[model samples]
Target: MKKVAFVVAAAMTCVATGAQAVDPHVAVGSAQYSIGISGFVPVICRATVDATVVPTQPGQVSLGSLNEFCNNPNGYEVYADYSPNLGKASLLVDGQKVPLGNAGSTRISKSNRAGIVARSVTLDLPQDVQSGSISFRVVTL
Candidate 1:
């Protein structure tokens, strides 16, 4: 009698444990449900400088033009990174003058705008210094 009772109790426990485990595929009910979606856009910018060099002032050298394009909706900014060899350089962007010491970045645009546009970039360097390279950068604002 005791053996039969122990076997019955063990079988009941196994059944209870199996019932406690829930299956992921089991559906609660058939009803309407909602789904979510998302998306993103990356910032893009490009710049090109003309090779044509035209001398303006005594120490100032003006390049042909700088073409820039940015996809940012808010606006964009232009910066001039001068090389270490340059001494006392300044930039003339659309007739606006921005002074930059030997090396570092300086903002050349007075009013930030988006899309493609061409502006004049001139370099005002010391008379002794000649033949130097400067890079331009565009960033979204």
Candidate 2:
């Protein structure tokens, strides 16, 4: 009887341990983005996230809200956009395709074509991301 009660208590405690979404430990240079100079125009940029900060699951990576900060030594205000539609942006660890996630391209960029135009989206990671080395791709729509 005591063992049964202890088992129940342990199970309850495990269930009570709610999960908190943790911010990803980003790789040193995992940056992928596309530049949209005009409506639907695109200039794609792709880079791999640092191997050190691997995703616990596929969804651990993500892109978030863009912000403005001081980047220039001369007091130039630099801007970061989560939306891939803009001219410049950062592709976060979370690069998914929701209302605010990565956009899957119906087509690939053409060699003849120099650009594309579309609304830029942010990056997203899976709720159950995998750990270890991972690859990320950033392209223009």
Candidate 3:
């Protein structure tokens, strides 16, 4: 009887150990992971003039015309190439400078593409301004 009882206890221990071997799992329905992913364009513009030299007689003279193209969204400005004697002359678009002739720099137009703005510039010439050549430029604002 002692031998039988010992055998029965050993069998029970083996059964208990085998029961614990079953793996328990918790259900994972869904999983997700995310990452945030993350640039500059330089402001650029071009300007061209129809004439290089403009001759004036002392009253008002029209200096051919100029066309400007700008890639900036806010548009651009045209200015007479800055010089020491630039402000001495007056540039008129309609009747006066868009801003005011400080160094002959004035804001001419504003557009998204600006395409080709053919603007004729008129200068009220002082007899002192002798015959010469002038230049214009476009810049993004």
| TM-scores of the models, in the order given | 0.59, 0.19, 0.53
Off by over 4 Å in 2: 1-52, 55-60, 63-123, 136-141
By summed lDDT, which 10 consecutive residues of candidate 2 come out lowest? 19-28
Instruction: Evaluate all candidate structures by whole-model CA lDDT and list the values in order.
Output: 0.69, 0.31, 0.62
What tens digits encode model 2's per-residue C-alpha lDDT throughout 59-108? 32333232222222222211222323321222332243333223422221
User: Which lDDT tens digits does candidate 1 get at residues 19-98?
Assistant: 44443333332342223345687878876789544443447677768888887888888777766655466777788878
RMSD of each: 12.8, 25.8, 18.5
Give the Cα-based TM-score of candidate 3 against the true structure.
0.53
Highest TM-score against the true fold, candidate: 1
What clash count goes with each model? 0, 35, 0
lDDT value, candidate 3, whole model: 0.62
lDDT of 3 at 39: 21
Model 1 has a clash total of 0
Quote the lDDT for 117 in model 2: 25
Model 3: CA > 4 A from native: 1-44, 94-104, 112-114, 131-133
Candidate 3: tens digits of C-alpha lDDT, residues 2-47: 9999999789666555544542222222342222222266666887
